[model samples]
Target: MSSRASAPTPPPSSPDTGALPMVQPAPSGSSPQGLALGLSAYVIWGLVLPLYVTALAPAGAVEIVVVRIGFSLLFCLVLLAVLRRLGELREALRTPSRWGATALASGLIAVNWLLYALSVVSGNVLQASLGYFMNPLVNVLLGVLLLGERLRRAQWAAVTLAAVAVLGMTVALGAVPWLSLGLAFSFGLYGLVKKRLPTPGHPVTGMTAETLVLTPVFVVGTVLLHGAGQLTTLTEGAGHFWLMAASGVLTAGPLILFSAAARHLSLTTLGLMQYVAPLGQFLVAVLVLGEHMAPARWAGFALIWASLALFTLDQARQARLRRRARRALTGSQAHA
Candidate 1:
């Protein structure tokens, strides 16, 4: 599909009282390319598990995030220049509230990343993958609670299945898989926070602000370490340096993909497809990386998948019903 010259006017920062209710702009229709790009972003993210574990082992999680965020900011600068979105960048920054909310998102995301990286490096990759598997259900709960979205009969059944799945996993493990759960919940909440924020020029602008929130700690931490000759950059291993740079680019690239994809796909479809990352991550963790799993663990994963299938089917049904309702309303108005 051809790109529109200008994006729709964004959502207002604050809603008014006793006036017309505000609506956030919906994504473009049937943008296959955008969906594909979004999936690809997660796909890249999913497939990089082993690399992240290996790359981050030497330096540590905080250091990795420091490098990732700083370099990612640089990467975004270059991309912004290439896309000629500097004007957009300027606007996003000018809106102090946008940047402030973005800074909050950044803090949330940083916590999520730290949890995930720690999980991966500490041989809990499989568990981390499981947390992501459960995340969609969490999002659904958020929709109901936070967005006032409702579920139909099938949707409710899906929720029940997801609960059972999480229960099964907890039972099988003899302990809650907290690392995975923490990552899932934190990241899902990050999305929610970002969702509530006014639309900025680019999705990454939030990440920029997020990074800014931690910049002082990140900078001072790295410097203090470097002063003691503890910085990984001093290792003189070209491979480590390259991975550090790649991490920065990798961090921002898929976000760019998803943002572009967001321009084209409906929110529901995008939300559903967001699972691709975890699926890819799960496969890589189990098959390629050879993360150990017991039969019970397998059972847990199976239940989770079963729950997701139920949820996904329900979502499809709702979409169909919505479409039919829309058509009926149009037809009735035409006859009148």
Candidate 2:
């Protein structure tokens, strides 16, 4: 064997269409079994939050985002080079409309990244996690409205519950959970846009392009600001600086895994797995990080979980029904 550690096996790619007559299998091959096996990236994400708040030089959210974007770009570029995926990147960028869409998603990711960093540093990883928990519903809604996909009744109930939870959070905060909601909505919408791209670059390479696009501007801005003695937070210490670079690696690693998962799993299963990251964060905040959630916050969490539970059950029922229907159709075809 080669000395180097093997790169993690990516989640399998989106599978072919459902063959059964009654089942409408997802365009993406999302398997619940594979989910448990392939989804460690979220756990990595959960651990990284505490590391995030504790490190990162001056530790402001904006600068964290800047460093994350810079380093993630570097990490992603390396992966792309190793895999030779630049042809895919060029193909994605070749179309004008797709190029514009990529640009839009990139901008939204920047906003989402900054908000998430702020939420973590400001002692609200729980809130950020909930926001992500809310994302699948938003994605489902997008499918209904934008993609014209038909959703089942149980899925509808899940969406309704999620909306209620958002309202509950707003009432508790005496303000909209803007940070959480914004992150959820923007990232969710980013996925929707990518879904439409005829050839969306692999998330890893796509994200790298975003950073590369912004890097020149970011460098120029940094130089100008530092020249005026305005950028003092760049290097507080060796420890903080290295931690800052690690954020970039952290950012892209999960996306690479998720893209792999996206290929092998259905959107519904992916949505449920998405909860793993935030739920871990919630536990860590309460049990490890020692953050507290008041009653209302706890209630908000309950509502979100209830919504997700309904969503998962609904998906399971659908899968079962489809399997039965497939068997029936096979028998009928044999008789003929």
lDDT by residue for model 1 (168-237), tens: 7788768888887787677667766766775353455545545555667678878987887768865858
lDDT of each: 0.65, 0.64
The number of clashing residue pairs in each candidate reads: 1, 9
lDDT tens digits, residue span 83-109, model 2: 999776677677787668767767777
Per-model TM-score on C-alpha atoms: 0.82, 0.81
Candidate 1 backbone clash number? 1
Model 2: CA > 4 A from native: 1-37, 148-150, 199-201, 224-234, 258-271
How does model 2 score by TM-score? Answer: 0.81
Q: Model 1 residue 270 lDDT? A: 69
Which of the numbered candidates is closest to the native, going by highest TM-score? 1
